[model samples]
Structures are given as C-alpha cells and as structure tokens.
Target: MGKNTQDGTPGSWFKITIPCGGKYDKTWLVNSIQNHCSVPFTPVDFHYVKNQARFFVQDAGIASALKDVSYKICDEENQKISIFVNPSNVPYSVRYKLEPEEMEQLKLTMNKRYDVFQQALDLQRLRFDPDLVDHDIDIILNRRNCMAATLQIIEENFRELLSLNLSNNKLYGLDGLSDIIQMVPTVKILNLSNNELNLVWELNKIKGLNLEELWLEGNPLCDTFPDQSTYISAIKDCFPKLLRLDGQELSPPVTVDIDTPYLIKPCKESYKGSETLKSLVLQFLQEYYLTYDSGDRQGLLGAYHHEACFSLTIPFNPEDLAPSSLCEYSKESRNMKKLKDPYLWVQLLKHTKRDIVCALGVLPKTQHDLSSFVVDMWFQTEMMLCFSVNGVFKEVEGRSQGSVRAFTRTFIVTPASNSSICIVNDELFVRDATPSETQNAFSIQVPTPISSSMSILSQEQQEMVQSFSTQSGMKLEWSQKCLQDNEWNYTRAGQVFTMLKNEGKIPEEAFKQIP
Candidate 1:
C-alpha cells in the first residue's frame, strides 16, 4: 500500500521489522508495547513471525500510541528496532465497517450543528473544508448504537473539540475515553448523560483534562452516589478545575490563611527586599538543594549550626486540610505533628550533624526541581536572615512513585563567620499537589523577586521581645523598636536606649505606646 492510503481500511496489525538472525522471544516483545504506549493501554493481542512482530488492537483508539509516531522496541541485548506507522491508513476497529454514505447519514441524524465525521479527512472530502475544523468542534453521536468505532472516529477527527454530546447513547464503559481525550486535550465541556455507564471510576482515566463542564446526570452512575456532595467531591478531586458538573456549578475552592497576610504573600516578588539580598538568598538555596536532592543529608550538616533545629510538617491536599500522620516522605514517618513538646522534639531531633543525618535517613530519597524554586527572603537582623523556598520535589528511591509534591522549607540563617552563614532553624512543610499543578510541575516559572518588609514575628520571637520589654520597664512597642534598631541584641538595646536618654536624644512619645 502507498504511504498515503485514504481508502479508510486499516492496514495490517502494527508490525515491527526486527533485524534478521536474532532469535527473539515474540510474546515478551509484543507485550512491552502496551506498557510503552504513551497512555499505556492494553492491546487485544500480538503475534510474531521469524523476523517481525505485530500488535493487534481492538480499535484505533487503543493503537493511538502507534499513530503518526516512531516507536522503538528494545531487546534483552539492548538492541533497538524502530517501528514506523503508516501515516494515512485509518486504523478503526474492524467492527465499525460503515461506508461513507452511512457515516454522512449518521451525521445528518445527529444534526448539522455537530461536526460528526467518519474520519478527519472526511471533513475535506464531504464538506470540502478541512481548515474550518481548526477551532472548537461540537459533535453529537447519541443513540446511534455507537461503540469503539464511533469513538475512533472522534479520536481521528478531533480538533479543538470544546463540547461533545454523546448523551442517550448505548455507550457502556469508557475504555477509549483516555485516548480520545489525549487526541483532543482541548475538550472542556462533555455531555455523557443518559448513558449506560454505571461507575464514576472512569473519571480517573482523564486525569490531566482541563474539562470545565461535564454533564452526566442521566447516567446510571448518578444513582451510585450516596449523595450529591459525595459525587461532586469525587469528581472535583479528579479534575480540580472542573467548574460545572451535571448542570450544577461547583463553588470555587477557597484559600484560607491562618497566618496573617503580612507573613506571606501570593508571590515572592511581593515580599519587599533588595535585589542584592534576593540574589544572595537564591544563590544559597540553589546550592543547598543541589546537595539535599542527591540523597545526602549528611552532606548538608555544614549548612546548619550545631544548635540548629529542623522540623517537618505536611499538610494534606489544601493548606487547611489536616496533615496526615506520615507524610509522603515515607510510609512511616515521625513528622512534627507527632511531637507534643518542644523539648521532646529537640531531644528526638538533636541539634547535631549525626542526629539530623539519622532523622533524614528514614525518608525517601528525593530530587527537587530547582527551576520551580520560589524564594522569599527577609533580613531579621544585619547578621541573621530568614528565607523560605517553595518548590516541587519527586521521590527518587524506596517507593520511587511517579508523583511530584510541593515542599516549603523555611531557613533562619545567621553569619557563622564573615564569609559564610549557618542555619539556626529549618522548618519544612510538604503537601500533595493538585493534578494540574503536578502535570505542569516542570513548566518554566518566572523567578519571583524576594525582599523583606515589616511583618509579624513567630511566637518565640514575640515572647523574647516581651521579656526584653518587661525587664527594661519600657513599653512593648518602644522595646521592640529599640531591639530592632540594635540589630535584635537584647543587652545592646537596653544600653543604647539608656545612653540615648542620658544624651537627651530619646523621644518621650516612643515609650508611651499603645498595647
């Protein structure tokens, strides 16, 4: 057959021309293609001759991986065999043997509004227009006794399909849904109501879809839900950006902040700090993550002070979601949530190199995506700086699960010497990311500028300020003001302010502050 065959008959089952004289096991070679397929769908069956092997798929949808692509088949010896697919031959299921006239009649029955074609080329042949299908497409193939054949057609012709109405159809299971969605990732609104599907489990099949609206009210699956709320939550969990489901609009998720807004902002650029300070902070983090990601916790011992404290907390789903006892770090983890007292936490996680190394040993090895790093820096004092780095990290060892999680590490660094700094405190927080975020985790992000501004302090720091105020008999505001002016030195602030008062330069109104 010619390279560009448009007769609509699928060519022979996908054949891989292997190098001659190599006695290869056929069964093992063909089975690997299913796993190698981009979507990783199962094939109907596969067979092999002496020097060639072929995979038979039930429909074109299952073989979507083989279409318009060159697939490599590797043998036990690490030898590679390249398989090239025929570009023009349509590979629909054998059961869907409909002629051009019948497809046109089916399209007419569905209505002229929807663009239902037998194949993508049918648009050019029948309607004499191919470019018109570039934008959004609305297709209706409901109640026409459609099966894999119909879905294959949709997959073949899929353009920027915005809405698809397959309602009141005999469509049973959504075996080809993933392939069709993969073909047309632009589909945002889908109506599969009045169908025979009984389970909503297929929703998981379309994990990375950007579907905005989905209508499945009349399906048998609707009755399976215990309540409307349960159904909505399950659907939303699968597709986080889903705005409307079964005609009911879901309320957008709210981002609640327990900490005051001043402590955190939407982006690092919002954190007011100088460019020079930000650059230094970024440089430190870039190097820090390089060591940390390589599964060498002991290597980072120098990054921390001998008295440094490191605690980790993991939030489930949203930030407000109560954290699981053991976060994604490992199956069994003694996270910060389990520690009841500060002394116990410190004792368990001793502020020493050996202790930190032992503590991190239990966690899974990880590789952080440095490009996604968002650093926000604030100068607590001339010698001490506080910064938080939020980015995505993937597990590299142990479970080696293909999931990327968002992690936030806040470090309090003080100058150990004139040229270097050591971490006094390191607070780490982890959370499961939304599907959309994880999908685009590797996408390039504009580096957010970091800076410092006046903001709230931690409870420990607040208590220290209060202690200084009580001992000095100065108002809390004046005491904090003096301490900040003296670079957070408790003893120096008292002496400096006293000297200022003795010199008659101290302002009287500074001491008389509001509570």
Candidate 2:
C-alpha cells in the first residue's frame, strides 16, 4: 500500500503496522532496524501509535530501502509480522492544523489549566481533561504537532508564564520543547515526571534552558543508569544550573566569576630571571615544539634525559565541556588526586627516553599555534630550569581530527652535553579551548616568499632574519633563505620551515650552527 512518486520512488514518510500482542518497545525497534537493515539511515523524527509506528526520513531512497527490509525484522515470538509502508496520506501541516472552532475550544481549555496568581500552567494528563474529553479532543504532548500548537497558544496569552508541569503525558520525545526556552523564557521550574522518555540524550533538545528546578522521576531513562549518583551526574551534565531535581536539593554549582573586581595585580606572562635566561627558555621551547609537532616523534629522543619522567593529566570530570574527545588519553592519565593506587602511579609514568618517545608516538598528530603561546618562567638556577607554556593546538589526524584543544605543558630541564638542555621532568594537561581561543586560533597570516634584494630590506626585516635563526635552531644562511623565500615575512618563514622539516625535505646541515 506504499505510495510512489511519478518516477516510482517511495515517499519520504512511511508507516509500519504490526499486530498488537507483544511488548515491542522503541528500543527494540531501533535495535532491529540497526541490526537487519543493509543501508544506513538516520530518521529525522519518529512517532509511536498504539499498533503502528511512523518514520520520517530525509529522502525517498531510504524509504524504499526500509520497505524492502521491513519483512526481515521479526517480533518477540520470532515471527515476521505483516507491515504496510504507506505514505502518510495527509500532509503534516494539514494534519496538525486546528479548525477555527477547535482553536477557540483549545484556548478555553488552556485558560482553565493556567494559574494566573502562581504563573504556572499544569498541563499534566491533558488528554484526560474533562472539557477536552467532552469535546472529543485529544492533545498528546508527545506528538510534535500538538506540542507546537499548545506552545503557540501559551506564547500569545501568557507572556509572563513562569512554571510548567507536563507530567504523565506519555511523552517519549521532546522534539518541540526548545520553543519553551524562547517563547516562555521566564519559565524556570519544569516537571516532566512519569513520562516514557528513555534516552539521556533526549534531554539535549532543551539543553540551554535556565531552569532552577526539574522533575524527571519515574522515567525509563532514570532506571537505565547504574545508580542514583550516576543518574544525578548525567542530569547535571545536561542542566548545570539545576538546584532541585526530582524533589532532591542538589549542591550549589561551583563556577568562577571572571568579572569580579579585584585589588591585587593580575597575572601577566613573566620570566623573573635575566633576559639571557629568558632567551634560552624561548629557544628551547621553539626547538622542542618544532620537533614534537613533526611527523616523526622519534626525532625527540635526544631532547629528554635518559632517566626523564613524563606523565599526562586530564580533568577528573568526564563530562567537562572542554575537550571534545578524551577516550584516546584517559586510560594513561596519571591524575594523582583520582589515581590512589601507588602501583598504577609508577606504571603510568614513563621513566626512560625510549619509553617516553614510544608513548608520544601513539598520540594524534598535532599542529600547535605558536603565536598563541604564553610562557612563564617559574624557577631558574645554574643546575636546572623550570617553566610552563600554555597554548592552543589542533589535532590533524586520528580519532579526534580537527578538534582544537587548550593545553598547558610544564617542563623541568637541566644542562646536558654540548650546550644543549634536556628535559628532566615533563607534565602536560589538556582541556577544551574557550570560545575566544578557538575563534582566534591559527588566525595569524602567513605570506608567500618572493625574491627581493637585500639592499631594499628594512632594518626590522634584517633583524627578523637573525631572530628566526636563533628561534628555529637553523643556520643563519638557511634562515635568511627561508625568510627571502617567504617574502621576508617572519611568521610565514617559520611556518614554511616547520612544514619542510616535518616532511624531511630540509637538509640536516640547515639546523646546525655554521662555524
């Protein structure tokens, strides 16, 4: 009974009917589709009726594919139930549109539900309302059409609406709930208890609502979590401002108020030592990051002491909004506060240069934004150097490709043979970059190199070539050639040098100092 277009393609919407006997829930249907269907598809919206389910896909090809494999899916009794993939005869807008008389009746019903003094609308058990039942009208909040119409009426009449209770409404999906955040912006207390909502991700539909109280008790999603603490944690992830949940008063959220007035001086990037020591630290960082960002991490074996120590740490809260993906490094994280086992503490630490380099090889390829780097020297002595560099970097390849992350790297180094410094201890902490950081990342322009006469260059340009040589660990001749190739632009020259170095195109003598 499925309808086809003039070209014999199936319609975008299809309904599947099965005999009402066994408990065929939404989770079962989703699993069956994922397991049996050969073609991969994501439904835009799904609705469940008493003995039928409707699926709205993006195109007709997916509809045809679903129809072809519909019979392959079996029920709890292992029997292939008959299915009718028919195009919804009525267009969605026409189906949900209310008649003039019906609109007036709905308005009247909503007026009865609204409490003007309390500024609350109690729409629980709306389908069973006596007035609606008398008028033979059924308003199911789970259906997108009904919810949209209800919110439209509330927006027009109740501009000051503060609280909304939508409990026991057989609601499984909140497709139209985001409108409340805009239409009823003042509404802070929401009650969605005793609903059929299952997946925790469904809460993402209304994630930005500034609600102080939320009630989601008696929902299927609550039981799916391992324990009550986990349930609360998951809910808090969605609603960080929630103070009360399901009749339980939660602890106040901890947050930093960056705008608070302060009398003390602000922290500025500083190196308390002399300029000579500062220059050494800068040169070291410039060389180390250049090698670290290169394709072959084995090249860094000489940068670390034979008995150096290295460890990585991540935020303890897995749901922290920062880093997009942490699974790649979470297992090896040596967070001292959370990791209490001494055995694990020793095992996670990389002790030798070989082990450290090997471990670094497994990390995703990265391109650091050197322009965004801020360094501060913590301690300086004849025996050792201690400092930290904070900056933004992009993952160029691997599971978290293209993700921008903020990182702080602390290094403890000591003088080694031949005037080189080697890392004695290193610690790296990574988190999600702030909005400003992500926006300004990699914004520095790189100019193309063009041949120009040295006589025409400015004093600043000549000085830049000398500085690039020291910072890049490249011979003066090679540094000058790189700058000239990049039109005498210092940033462009550095970027080109790094690219050539990573690709193994630069000669070894280019990085060595000329006699």
Candidate 3:
C-alpha cells in the first residue's frame, strides 16, 4: 500500500438521444451551442434546436385592460400547436435561448425602426394610422416623433422583443441600437432595407448574437467612395460570421486604368519598377481570385523572377523522385522591375546526374556545419551549374546524418543555348528572352572576400524567405519550426531583417533585435 494508484476509465451509458426539428420559433440556442462545440452533437439533435421555435402567439391583460398575445409551437413532424391561444392559460415554464445571428438581424432591423420613428415624429402623426403603416408594429405604429417615447413605454410591458420596425426614414446614426442588441437576450429578424444614413459602426460588437441577415440597401452615401470594394473586402475578411449581405450589390472589382498616363496620381517611389507587370498581375488577380483562393494552393507570386529570383521549393523524402529547388531574393536589393512580359520559366531538359535541385530535411532542424555543392544540374542537351544560396546544414535528432538546406533562388546560370530549356507544356508561346533580356540575377558584390559573418542574403535567399509566407504561413512560420531552441545572434538578426525587408510586409524595425 505504499505506492498505490486508482484505476480510471470511461463510464457506460444506457441510451443516447438528441432532438431534431426545423422551426425558427423553437427558442433553442442551437448556433450558440453549435459554435461553442459541434463535434459531440448528432445532426438530428441540432436540427431540432433550430426548427422547433417557441414564440408568442397571444397575450392577456392583467388589470382588465383586454391585452392579448398569442404564441405558437410545432412538433417533430411540422405541426403548429398553439401555446397562448387563451390569454389566461400559460405554460408552466417555457424553454428558449436567443441566437446571436437573430440578435444581429435584430440590431440591423432596429436602425430601420429608429429612422421610421424619427420620420413619424417629424410628421406629427400621433394616432393609429391606416395609410402610413409600412409593416407590423405593436405600440408606436404611425406616430409622430413617438419612437423614443413609445420605446420607453413599450419597455414597461413586454421584455423579449429585441427588434423594432422603423423602416424607410432619415436618421443620422443607429444610436440606442446597441443597447437593444446587447441587452435583449432574445431577438431575431431585422429589416433595415431603406434609409438615408452612413457609417454604422457599433453593431459589430455583439459577440455571439445570431446575425444571419443584414439589409443596408437604399442608402445614397454607401457607394460614395470609389474604393468601397476594397473596404468591404477588408471588413468581410475580418468578420467571418457575417452570413448574408442584404445591401445594394457590392462594388465590382476594378482594374488600374493606366492608359491615362497623363492623369497620374501621387504615389511613393515603389512604382518606379515595371508598372506594366504590376498592372498585369493586378488584372490576373481580379480575374482569378475566387477560383484560386478556394483551394490550398499557394497564392500568386508576382514578378518573382524579375524582381526577387525566389524559386519555389517542396520538401520530400530523398527517394530519388523529387526535384531540387532553391530561392534567390535579397532584402537589401532595391525593387527594380526587370522584365516587361514577366512569366515563370521552367526548362524541360532531360534530367542528368549533375542536375542540381534543392532538397529539404537533408539538413537537420538544428544548425550544423554549413557546406556548399556546385551541382552540375544535368539537363537534356547540356549541363548547367546550380549553386545553393546561403547554404546551411543542420543536425536533427533521431536522424543518422546531417542534412543540407539553402534557399532555391535566382542566380546567373550559364545555359548552353537559348533552346537549352523548353516548356514541356507551354513552350510554343515562350519567347526566347535570353537571360540578358528577361532575367534579373541576384546582385553579388564582386571580387570581395565572402563576408561569411556579414550575413549578406543573395537575391534567391531573400526571395525564398520572403515567399515563405504563402506556403508556410507567415514570416515566423518556418523559422519557428527550425529555430526552436537557438538564440538569435547578430548574423541571424541580419539574415532575419534581410528576409523581412525583401518581403515588403514588415517595416525596417523588423531588422532590429527584440529588446
């Protein structure tokens, strides 16, 4: 009994059950529960949470005032059963959970109500109306400037109502809408289809409000700016839960109209490089983003050959089936547009023993003795020498020997002829733009003893590190995997800065060591 332990195991259950029905008035917090954790649920149970709604069908008066509010309920097979048909008979205790989307839709709908409320107030329509009625409203229907007063009074009676009807009117901002959205535990269904307002900011904060639909159409200033598409895209990218957009059609993607070189706008010095290639790239992106972004493929690499010499690389087991790859780029190198019709160049030369292709995992994850091998890349018809850019070796655990690693990159390779490489699939259209015309090899300072300590990045090394974002994740991705334990030295800092600056994402501050 000196060192004893208790046995631990999962307990058995007699039965497993979940509800399944499709009714909006079910008053079940389905999405809230689902979003919180969905793996444990059966689909049938989730459906029941959404469809079997519990809403008021009738109401009753307390002080003989003749108040009546009716509620309805549906069963598993979609049959409507009345709840509060007779105002006096109330259920013992009803179960209901407010959804987040419903709250959002309610929030948007309140904006419409506020505007309508303002209009009715301005018009001075105080009595129950026959003509000015836009939709069903309980207390403040067709009243002149009575929204605030009506809401004040209505808040005294019913509590669950989160949305109001104030469609089609003039309101400066959707104020107090946040209170309704935040305070109301249960509210869904908002309709803000018509109004004269701009800049709705506060409604975005309702963390888990079930907001499925949003109607912000019929606003004049919504499209006042030409760059609205960029703005919208940026916002939607941030708010992933936004389900629907019931506004005026979002602006279409735009292409740079560079024909009016005479009508140039102000910009920084970065545009001095090949603007034609940039424009082409922008056009390609505008045309292809939807089809491109849907899958796990890497993103677009623009002018990589002309500007960065960053060769794309793939890691594979060294079973004699993978192509050697490396990158060539430089952070210190100034951005210069080189080629006019920039395109990827892949040679279909026959593979040879000397054919050089960069490989990964051959280098250990830990830093090791660095070495260089001038691969006589064997290709069809001729041989070309391929050099590893900033090559380094690493010693990994559980592995027998150390591995080699260097970025696949852009460099001056002396090809045998203009016909030395041909596109196996797309050679017919590739013009014979020799290296002198189309290529931008890495900028190497000549005749100087190699500053092994200076940590100067070749154009290829810079490009490989810079282009790492699209594939690996971000600047810190591959580095995090590779540099788990090592401390950053001055050379490492220099190399890190060179990679970041070339990427054009982080500023020069990234080059400095962390304090």
Q: Give the number of the best model, judged by TM-score.
A: 2
lDDT of the candidates, in the order given:
0.55, 0.71, 0.30
What's model 2's overall lDDT?
A: 0.71
lDDT of 3 at 430: 10
Stretches of candidate 1 exceeding 4 Å from the true structure: 1-92, 115-158, 255-271, 274-515
Number of clashing residue pairs in every model? 4, 5, 67
Off by over 4 Å in 3: 1-146, 149-165, 202-210, 234-240, 247-515
Give the C-alpha miss distance for residue 409 in model 3, angstroms: 14
Candidate 3: 10-residue stretch with minimal lDDT? 422-431
Q: For candidate 3, lDDT tens digit of each residue in 1-515?
A: 01122111212101111223222322233233334331333111111122232212122222111111111334455554332112222211111112334323333444333443222112222222333233232223222113333343334333555344445644434432423433453444344546665643323423235544345566554565444433343233323233445643332222233343222223445756336434433343322222222221111111011122222233323474543222111111122232223232233221211111111112123331111212222222223223222223222343422233333322222221221211111000111123432122111112233334124555655454455433434343333322221122223333443443463634332232445
Predicted candidate 1 versus true structure: per-residue lDDT over 1-515, tens digit per residue: 01232333555344333343124433344455545666654443122333454434434554556553343666667766565443233333333345554455444433444554421112211222222233222222221223343555555545656777656655555544544554677778777777777776656545557888888877788888665655665566567677888897665432211222232223354555455455556656755665565544444545666567766666433355554533444332235565557665555544554355455655667767555677777545655778888888767655546567888888887665424556788777777767876866543222232232123766766786789877766656666666665447565456555544664555555454546
Question: What ranking emerges by TM-score with the best candidate at the front?
Answer: 2, 1, 3
Indicate which candidate wins on lDDT.
Answer: 2
What ranking emerges by lDDT with the best candidate at the front?
2, 1, 3
Candidate 1's error at 274, in angstroms?
Answer: 11
What local lDDT score does residue 69 receive in model 2, on the 0 to 100 scale?
A: 71
lDDT of each residue in 143-230, candidate 2, tens digit only: 6767877888999998898899999998887756755766778888899999999987778657767788999998999899765555
